[model samples]
Target chain A: MESGNLSAGEERFRKFSVYRIVEHLALIACFTVLAMTGLPQKFYSLGISQLIITSLGGIDSVRSIHHVAAAIFTVLALQHIITAFIGVVFLQWEPSMLIAVKDIHDALHNVKYCLGMAGRPAMSGRYNYKEKFVYWFILLGGVQMIATGFILWFPVIAANYLPGQFIPVSKVIHTNDAMLIFLLTAIWHIYDSIFNPEVFPLDKSIFTGMKKTTRT
Target chain B: METVINNKSGRMGVAAYIVCTALLVCFALPGQPSFAASEQGPRKVDKLFGAEGNADEDERNQCLKCHGEKGSIKKFPDGDFISTYVDPQAFTSSVHRSLRCTACHKEFSLQHHPERSFRNKLQYRIKESHVCRDCHKEGTIKSVAVHESLFRKERAGEAVVCTNCHSAHAVTPAVGGNASTGEEKYCLRCHSRETKMDFNDKECISLRVNIAELRNSPHKNMGCSDCHFGFSQENHPQRRFRYEREYRISSAEMCRKCHFDKYSKVSESIHYNMLSTGRLDAPTCIDCHGGHAVSSLGDNRALAVMKCRKCHGEVYDTYAKSVHGKALLNANNKDVPICIDCHSSHSIKNPSSSAFHDYIPEMCGKCHSNPTLMGKYGLSTDVVKTYLSDFHGMTLGLQRKEASKGYRPDPPMAVCTDCHGTHEIAGVLGADVQVLKDKLLKRCQKCHSNATSNFPDAWLSHYKPSLRVAPLVFIAEQFYKIIMPLMVVGLLFQVLLQIWRYLANR
Candidate 1:
């Protein structure tokens, strides 16, 4: 809303809300701690793993730290879901992150432009195809990790109704999803934000909650 | 002139023949007297048990002829009676039947026998026993400290003698002479006697052996000479051992001859190591089992613990207070291990050794993992299995597995003893859960220097993951299992679609 009164020479648009930015920061912090503590347990024999574990005071300390981080992450995720639900239902806000047919078209058009088959780039709104894809991936991955993490954390209670096999199944899923998100973040999200020529150094819009725009 | 020369040469040849015959007669005359003397019967004795005329018969037979009659007695100036008669039949049947009487009594001769003068028969016997060294050689006899100490000048009269054990007329060959029976008979001659074995008449040496006990031992069939090297009927009491310790230390050497493999293993044991450090009380072979009365090490497990308790009384007391030892005593549990089960019998190593450290987990696991065994005591058998899955357990297991392949894994992995303790393992069952947690926290802090109070909660404490026990962890694990594969496959398809679109446009 502040950008609405901006002069012609200097124009910008608001992207992320303060609430979203805070949530993102929380996610980053929790995810980093989780990876730092959890990955060592999986690859425990590595020298660096042992170093990290010992520096964190040992396996028990690492595990405690991991559980605390996981708990924080789960709470943040729940807050996000609650915020999204309230915005969509109570405030009559459009769920822009929801996938639509136009997103697919836009993806195709963008691919054509990348291949030099189109004269113009596909039009994007508040979120681009890449941004929507990563957003959805993060939401889905967070939900899955939270569910399985809770199962592993309270296996005795879960096994009351669920088959015994589910315990080990949850373990496998937790490990694989962890690796998947790590690879996705490294290869896709980092490349789009930091490594791409269009946003070479970094995409500062998320941090500042504003994006530069051109007025025609 | 030729006839005169031939007559002169014949006269000179006759004179040379007469001179050669006279030289032969002179040479034969000296040997003929002795030859004529032997042809006569046994020479007559002038004085009994005294210096007398020479005998014409064989020296051994001539001596035997005078002493051959039974019950022939001689009275001395001190009113002491001496038995001069020897049993000819017993002498013939003896192991030394082929030997001459003068072999042991070199001072005695037909013409000049030394006058025997001693306060007691033991003194005279000790004096005469010096003749054994002439043939036996001091170098050979001094191989044992017992002989060296007894043969010392100050101990001369008190020393054991050859004639004290071996009969003068009937000395037996040490070997191949009914050795087991002979060795027992010959050794017991001085040993079984209460008065004859008095050393310097000060300490009455009770060299008595319980023959029945010895005969009942596992070494019943083995001869005494088999173990007592350099022992013989002629040298019956090989050494007059002054100290029991010296005899025990020397006799242990004989065990190595038969139990070479066990001896070699024990040489590297902690017991042997202690001995090398000059701990006189440290156990040797005889300390655990009696030398002559050694019995079989039967399946009585408590015997080993008792043997170890003889020296390690304090450690045994601590162990007796432990859970395992209490279980053994209270429940009469044969399955419970004693000292040998963990430390081993002959090849015991120091507890601090790296090999012993690595071996602890598996050694504990041996019984702890047996479901049937643990179930009897209401203990969970999954302790080892659950531990192996934990981070610390996994590291230790990996290190252990790697070590088997000859890799010296990193030290200081948290093993069973690191938590439960090496000797003072208490019953954790029915203990207050919070107290146990506190104890575990303390254990964790040993390695985890910066550990918090909440750090111990991370350990599931041998509990396997189940829905009811760890519901959150179980659900989280399950959710990821399904979602991960779907996400991976879906993402892979999207990647492929993007690649195709780029390729198609190109």
Candidate 2:
């Protein structure tokens, strides 16, 4: 279960640690709660939005739940970053998820393959170009959301250091970024992980920390 | 032989027919007596008319001969007495001077005077006043429940009659005379009394009204009948109210008749709403404006405040201890706001309503943003200007506009009263800076969870950004103002480009 061998007869490879799987699970839970609570506030006048708010015990309760989930999400995100840093600095592991010049080359090659100009698909490392793109987009979007979310959550404190105008600006950024992330997750991420032909039902490696592989 | 007999019969028949026609003509002639005339022999002539050779004047003179002397009295068997005397001069001066006494007293005669069966003089007068109904049938004399109840319950001696207010001999036209003064005098006859007036022998209420005060009132020229439209001396005390509340509620109805538009607006007010819900203490027209002594409200701020204080004692006390109230008391400042200034005089909605809550910042803005008004007190007018630009104030403005169009706004945004007090508003300028900060932080903590001492420092205190005040906030706001639009455009472009590329590939 703890192996990542690529031997000729090997049928499975460990893709993630148990700790990483647990973290991913926590992220999923926190993100789901945050979206459930936060999206309704943005589309407050919609009937379903109102129903959601009421089912969660009114707006104030929704807000409290949202804030709690946001805190958990922030913690999980920080933990992921810290773990990656520790793996690279102390354990001498390469950060395969980091975008590099090689990733750009692979992205172009993949596009050519998609266009039928290339006979074979580009070889990828631990993460593919598509996976790397989504990873970095979410990471950057997460940082922006965190900054704006904190400013909104603690507006009075923010106002001490920032202009009063920043409060509204933070609101705009927080809402828009949330929409972007939600759309990306719903369309790109979900399609790749579950709806794609190669991963018909789901790519369960994130949850199980193991994936079956076929030798070329 | 048969033809001759038939012709003779026809001739006889024609003659009989001619005789019948002549007899009918004689009977139909002007001088001939009719069957009805023969039966009743000209139904005993009403005393209002006289025999062939006698004039109506001669018959009235004959009655006047006995009634002309003063102190001419008719004493009944029941010891109830009535004055039969008619004042000649008064009768001559009256509008009914040309009319005979028998016009009303149709049974009057020298030979057979009708027997008086009334229990008292009042009952007789009430019965006699019915003659006015024949000519004065203006359909305005319907019996009101109160007066009817009193008539049924009270003794005949205590009953009100038309003659109590209108003299029989001196009767004048109700329309042509100085009606306001005449009606006032009529009402004052019983009402000006200092003692309690008995009604039905079961209850007594003060009949006293200040005649002097009424004469000086804004409604001095208006007749009592203007408001009490259906009331008459005969129908005094129109409705029997069970309590003061009933009386007040009915009186408000009367006021609504004339002041309908204003009254309708007030009906939606908090006071009227409370009154309708059985809070008898709520103010009505006469509560703020005196019943008979109503004058102009004018700029009498103190009196107006006092009137509101009658029910809002606690709020008044709090206000009096506040800076505005203190300034008003100590300096007699006209600039300081009173209860009416903020809440308004009438048509005041519930303070907690979203509409009213949204309007509060604007209400404060009325005086605070007035340069000419606040300038005298060394107060800056930019308070509202700055607030309007602030996030909370902008939200409140938007909410208010939406509310005016009948939308229930999202949860309340912080308004002027959110931080400062409502009735107990104090001057934040003279207060110690540290204390104000602590108070502001406490106020912030009401909505904000886990607020710290530094949280209150975020407030610009109704001031816009300047280099000295909030430089960091100013820079951050400017940065985002430019960055947000660019970020949105860039993301949108990327999305469009990706979609186009996907379509092209497909």
Candidate 3:
């Protein structure tokens, strides 16, 4: 969602728009609910998971809540795609989140600098390699989840067009990829946003739409 | 473990049990007894001196001193050997313990120890039985419920002696007393006899019970009155029953006393449902557990299947051939299910119900979903996950989801039993994949009449796709397996780099 150049900011200049902030928050809400409902089903044998299922009224209620959240999540994902499309096509916007050679060089440079092999850290553009990593991982993973989830939801209809193997394949991907997404969000995104020494408490730019510039 | 669940059965079940028990209480006919050995506990020939015991203890002790000799234990009159080695403890504990030996042994004295002779044990028992009339007048004996028939039989030259039902030496209190004592001995005295009690002409139930077999039963510690309840020498109330069904139903009611959990489940079961609605052929507790010699299903799981075989012999035969049944019966595999594993022992509902059909996946999943369990059998634990993701399971899931939302699709969805038959589920152990595919294709055609042979290929058959099976699905799975880790490593590496940069800068 960070779209401006690295140098296009003054002191605490605006970075994300309100629309982008709302989208991120909505995604967070959907993702949280999904994780809570889905992981228990995945680990159904666990006592705590069973408690959660029972407390939430049972598997049916849990699934329904998950479905509703997933629907909202799917819509939000589509909204992001369409909004980005309109921005790029109609308004001639830059595809700032796209990974490039600079990101590779920057990643390598950053690693080297951290390891004391380089004198300077790599300079990031609108979005750093880390930010881009999170964005692409979640977006692609969401697409996968959505596709599989739909196959799971309307599987009888899916059987008409898709092979029978796709049904089980969708389940495997749905279950496994969910864990991956959860891990990345927990370790990487959480670390970068809040636990990083640079942003000890949080990186509030996504919420407040402003970044405090520290130009060298 | 399976049968004895909590007594959470509905009021209907409670009602059924109570009704059956009430009927049994009404039809309380006294059965015959055979008490040559049962009444006599281990003889205390030497220890006949309990000087500190009750009133008649001293006189009985002196009598036992002579009658309770070790080697001369039995009276061998022709072929019949009646126990003469009276147990001093048995005599001391009897209802008539205070009575001297001379009270019943009339015309015998210390000076003349004249042991009389008879043609047979029956004739001896009958002749010695006249001593009871010396104390209990004929009118008083006739007033007792059992005596109405027994007295008539006596007149017609077919009566059992008083000691036939109530043993001579060890007649425990006939009225209210301790149950832990020789209460069963009182009933077994006659019940041990190979005789029959006719409820009607055709409904002759065998009055015999093998004492050793009864002792070996799980209820060895319990007395006869514990189940046959309210039956003792106190009274043999005249019982009336149209047929044996009445006895069976009432007899089945005995289980709920101690085995209330199992009884509750049975009451909720389809068997009980049938019985409640007057389907007399429906099985009850005694039908499954058996009478007197009640069994423990836990020690012998296959016996549980055999119990069902009484009525469902054909189904049991089919099940015995099934992989589960074969494993259970042949290998004695405790892990595998017998009949009660699925159908349950007591509260077995109709397996054909929609609710039951819908739960097939979950029932099978108890074992299939466990990674450790499936791993032991070399089966993929992905069975449940794959099925839930499949069209059928998904449809069922949707129906539940819809029902939660206040409606239901209720589409005729297949479950585990739908594809792989219930009791006759095909063996996964070394099963030919081709044969399974053929079977699956046939199963599919049951619902999808227009389905081609290729239709079965769509179903991955519980296995997580591998290089050998469903390679397309395997590749897709492998792709994610590889990519998910790579993505996570990349993301984490960036986080480390950023953390280091920030600390170094600071």
Q: Which candidate has the highest DockQ of all?
A: 3
lDDT of 2 by residue, B1-506 (tens): 12422466643433332222111111111111111121111111221122332355676678888898778997766797887888665554443555667777867765667776877766678788767545433222223333344345435555445444445655543322222126565556446655353434356667578989888898889877788777643345545566665566667667787788879889889989998898887889888777887778677777778888887899999889888888876776778898888888888888888867878878998999999998888898998887776557654544444454465644577788889878788898788989998888788777775677766766778666666666655655566567656755654554444444455555
Report RMSD (Å) for each prediction in the order shown.
14.3, 15.1, 15.1
Candidates 1 and 3: which is better by TM-score?
3
TM-score for each of the candidates: 0.55, 0.56, 0.59
Clash count list over all predictions:
43, 2, 6
Give stretches of model 1 more than 4 Å off.
A1-41, A44-180, A183-216, B1-150, B153-164, B167-260, B275-282, B330-332, B397-411, B431-435, B438-455, B467-479, B496-506
- Which residue window of length 10 is worst by lDDT in model 1 chain B? B39-48
DockQ values, each candidate:
0.11, 0.12, 0.20
TM-score of model number 3: 0.59
- Write the residue-wise lDDT of candidate 1 on B218-261 in tens digits: 98887777888676544434355454555566678789889999
DockQ of 1: 0.11
When 1 and 3 are scored with lDDT, the better candidate is 3
lDDT of 3 by residue, B1-506 (tens): 11211234533332332222212121111221221112222122111222223555565667778787755544545777675677665565554454577767867655567867777777777877778666445554565566567776678777667765555666543322332225564455456676566676456778788888778899888767777776754546677676788878877887788888887887788988998899989987778777877777667888877888899988888888888888888999888877777776677879976656667788888988989877878778888998987556765754554444454333457888888787786586688878877888788878767566556766777766789988977887788879888977877777777667777777
lDDT digits (tens) for residues A1-216 of candidate 1: 466656777577778889887888888899899999988878877889878877776665677899999999999988889989999999998898988888999988876776668865677778888899888888898899899888677665565556544555666677777888876776678767886555669987788888766544
- When 2 and 3 are scored with DockQ, the better candidate is 3
Model 3, which residues run further than 4 Å from truth? Answer: A1-9, A214-216, B1-141, B144-235, B251-280, B285-307, B313-418, B426-435, B438-459, B476-486
Ranking by TM-score: 3, 2, 1
